[model samples]
Target: MTAPAPASSAPVPAAARHAAPPARAHAGAPRWARPGFWAVLALAAVLYTWALGSNGHANDYYAAAILSGTRSWKAFFFGALDAGSFITVDKPPLALWVMGLSARVFGFGTWSMLLPQAAAGVAAVAAVHSAVRRSLPGTAGHAAALVAALVMTLTPITVAINRDNNPDTVLVLLLVLAGWLCLEAVRDGRTRTLVASAVMVGLAFNTKMLQAYLVVPALALVYLAAAPGTVPRRFGRLLAAGAALVASSGWWMLVVDLWPAADRPYIGGSTDNSVWDLVVGYNGLGRIFGGSGRGGGGGGFGGESGAERLFNDVMAGQISWLLPFAVLALVCGLVLATGRARPVAAPPSAEAPVGAPPPAREDSGARRDLPGARAALLLWGGWLAVHYAVFSFSSGTFHPYYTTAMAPAVAALTGLGGVLMWRAHRRARAWAWALPAGIAVTGAWAFTVLRRTPEFVPWLAWAVAAASAAAAVGLVAARIGPRVRLRIAAAALATGLAAGLAGPAAYALTPLGSPVNGTNPTAGPAGSGGFGGMRGAGGTPDGTRGGLSGGTRPEPSEGTPGRPAQGTPGQAPQDAAGAGTRPEGMRGGPGGAMSEQLIAYLKANRGGAAWLLAVGGAQSASSVILSTGLPVIAMGGFTGSDPAMTVERLQGLVSAGELRYVMPGGGRGGPGGGSGGSEVDAWVQANCAAVDPAEYGGQDSAQDGAQDSARDGARSSLYRCG
Candidate 1:
């Protein structure tokens, strides 16, 4: 087979380039065609919001922070886990700000907190469609755009994350929007448009910090290489964009870092209580280079670091369904666009001297016909490559769902590749085989992913294999006859799409069957293993399924620091938020309630205390705060690793009558040794009396051998300090 031609790296002169022919008039198209876009959006909305309330404060960790923010503007701004502003959640508060405003207006229910993420997910689909359609013109472009939107809407991980309140949902939307805006700027070489793209990236930074910058290289590469400008002009505009990026991303960090530490919440996940440390240390470098307290929990998640990490048993099912096809599209699109172009003379510009020939036109035919296609390929292709490398090899805490960032790129490329290869098929060129090849690879990958959970839907793998084989054969046979080619190719393409999409579509639908785990959200059947080989059922050890299932959520324990949360098989879940009776036959619910007896006792005995109770980590504190809409301090932040509180501080709170109850290890995270953990534990043990378990429905906690009567996972024991 002949090798595909190499892509040209040199820029096309601005004057020589001609716009691609206009796409079919979308307005003139049949009415049925117009609703296709809205239908995809509506499907996305239903997928994201269907039974959203059943999630019930999904990822109680962020839910608590949102709840706290609703009550205290200070807590809201800082992303604090408690309204008293003890310590903020690990990341920046922009996502919290979005959710908090919704909660404030709508009354802090599951719907209010999660609806923002759902909306972002829908907007992201629209952005992906618009970007892809704008990048690839004409009828093919419209079809590709729809395909991209559908793939994005149905990606398993996208579905799972969109239904929850993680900051990543907002992060994905902003980054995709940035890509769209960057494409828009490329069309007109508008500095404002480019800066707007940068601004989106900056806001994305505030959503998830450095993760947002991963697309920066792609954006800059496309604009600097393909935009209509001289080299120096492009460089200067990029500089201006760089300044906008820094300003937008750093404003919040600057404000938080400069705020007096005593007045605001302690920056969570940082050793020094500084947002800069959280950025440059934990969330930034710590992610690239593993460290002890840098939010990695000692680097165990996303499988081993290698090229195959994404396709590994732990992660393949989340984002790899269309990855292989995307790779093929990227290479083919760039090469074909470049190789087919032939320079030709153009009309003289106003600046040209009297009879000067159109200064040797540099780009022609294919490139001129589809100007934005190559640029789009560069943006999405580069995005996929950079993220794949980082997520595959990064030493820090990696979760399967982090791959959601890769979804839009993969989706766009799939659409582009399908259209590009189908066009080649019509010409019956050597590249025509790519369409069949892509189908085979995708179907095989889907089979492999489905086989990983063989029992989930037993026939899925076989069905995918059969469809792929038939489609590949049908496409190949279409070459034998002109009369049947068109009809044969269309049917085969649809079949191939069904084969490629089956696995992810199944996985995406799994979340609707069972509630997604808010903390470690993964999409698959109940027992399908995800990251770290944990069951998809909320990471429970004893086989109970559901995000808020009893015995799954991490409970405070005397276990070693950094130990993952564990649950016994038969115990009722105490920390599940929004626990209540579901409509008969409904599959999802927290399944249990916060100990009302314990909540009442704390409320009655508060006695002017500033905090209702103190728990070792966010998990324990979150439940109480969510239940009562009151301040319940999370001593060590998300993982009980941050040095948010000292022994002296605990003593002061107790001494001032501002605090009375302390529940050591009340969350999945144990007390942080760096935060006066041992000394604090000793003071509580020696100076405080163990409250009787009978007073609060036998849920009182015991530490240091003080009447061990705690029940419901032994997490609710409290120490009464006077």
Candidate 2:
């Protein structure tokens, strides 16, 4: 028609001139997008809440605390091991507060106790979706946001932890909220918004102490670099936000510290009954340096410390399925999505002379998207990097469940990277190879993870490999097949998504098939032992797996295997090996039959005593308290190792008639040592009368060598003290 245009004079598309397009307003997005977001959340809710009660009193250590909290506001505030408030749990009580409030309102039962975490999981998925959608607006943003939410919802560890009672569930939600708030501050340039973001992190700190700070560097750096303000103003606002962070995180710690030691419960996991010591020595540097937690046993749980630790047998099933793909996305997104903003032309105005070049307005329209895309890449990429570094190599107690903290970052980057690569593929750019590369790596990794549990859905690994290969090939074919590009792209996306998600989706569904281990929740087949085979191969009698001990049947202390140790009736009664009221399904408790008898005996005989029984550790005391809702003092705390009770303290309780019964091995015996010893054991042996095991329907295990074994075994006979 008109003269053909020269190569140099061809009209440039708006996208070619700008690094990224501005986000479209939420109201302008397709109506289907809103419904799709809610659908993702609904899916998460169903996944988290289904068959939750199968995990009865999940992590009864914390479950016991929740019950105690329901009975005593003091216990609720302090996260006490028993209603008597003798000692606090090792962790802070923010999570307890949420579960406690729910229990209080709904009545403390399995459903009420676990529902909060399930709700928190859905909220976390929602937070991730919102963060991604708002940061990357328009059609692409919607796709990325939905994909991110779906990935998070299907993450194996994310599903397992949310259904259980761990504090990590709430901690993950709070951290995500903080990330979103930080993003909002960057978009709006508001100091108040930034302060709110810091407050969220502080709350997360209270949830899990130092673990919550993992995302702080990313949150602060993103704002400092990309927020709409001068460098000094951003720094000043950050200072103010930092002050807010300190205030919110410290108020509870300060209150607990200032309260008179005699008036409040003893701080658990501390060498000297100080919360500060627990924070600094046990939960802090001790976790990273090793040998700082209770009994100096912080030598990192799960597996060996190295860059590949996340892929180890103990952890790979829980989190590694998507890890390689997330890493690839992070690298490709950072490299391909970054570019200088082009000077966009403004629409001609009335005052501008005819043919005058429109004033070159920089950072308009798509140009603004460059900083946002890069900022998002940095925020999520840094989150994944920092957590990966810490969890993979930190020489502390590294439970597989701890990987839930990485889920959001992994989900976000996968969505972000997939969407960015798809955009490149559509344009037939050099970076189009990213999509195929991501699919291939993710498929291979998923196959590898599935092979670890070969018996579990054995066909799934081959299916994933096939889908990934087909998808990668289709993506390559789309480059030259212009007439069929749309069909190929859609098929490739479906196959790639199926390949990427199949392994995690199968793992995520495993929790529903059986009750996951309460103490260390791992998402796999029933006998997967927990992270690194921490649980015994077959699991425990009550279905709760033991920590470090693996829930193996205890070797007989006397008589013969599988029989209670026999001894003189009046001698300090020996452990029946694994006997006790299985008050709940917590590992290291007396067998359910034995514990019922024991709880019944204590309830009947606990007249006028301030405490119904005093046991060696929180493990045993938690079992007893959960059974009766009565005060049972945990003598030494978590491992029977915190030195919460001494000979003098036990004597004072006996002399005051506040404590009447004593059992030594509540949890792995609080024996004599440089670290808080069993002087209380000696005191009780001297001043207390051993009740005959026959008196309470208990087997007589008090044979030769029984006393020594009693300190480490699950069940010990009752002793009566005036």
Clashes of each: 5, 14
lDDT of 2 by residue, 221-323 (tens): 9888778767899999999999999998888899999999888999988888888888887777767766634424533456788898888777787788888
Residue 394 lDDT (model 2): 76
Query: Model 2 Cα displacement at 550 (Å)?
Result: 5.5
- Give the lDDT of residue 232 in candidate 1: 99
> Please, what are the lDDT tens digits per residue for candidate 1 over residues 320-435?
88999899888877776666556767767776667767755744335455667877888899999999989988888887788999999999998876787788777746766889
| TM-scores, each model vs. reference | 0.86, 0.86
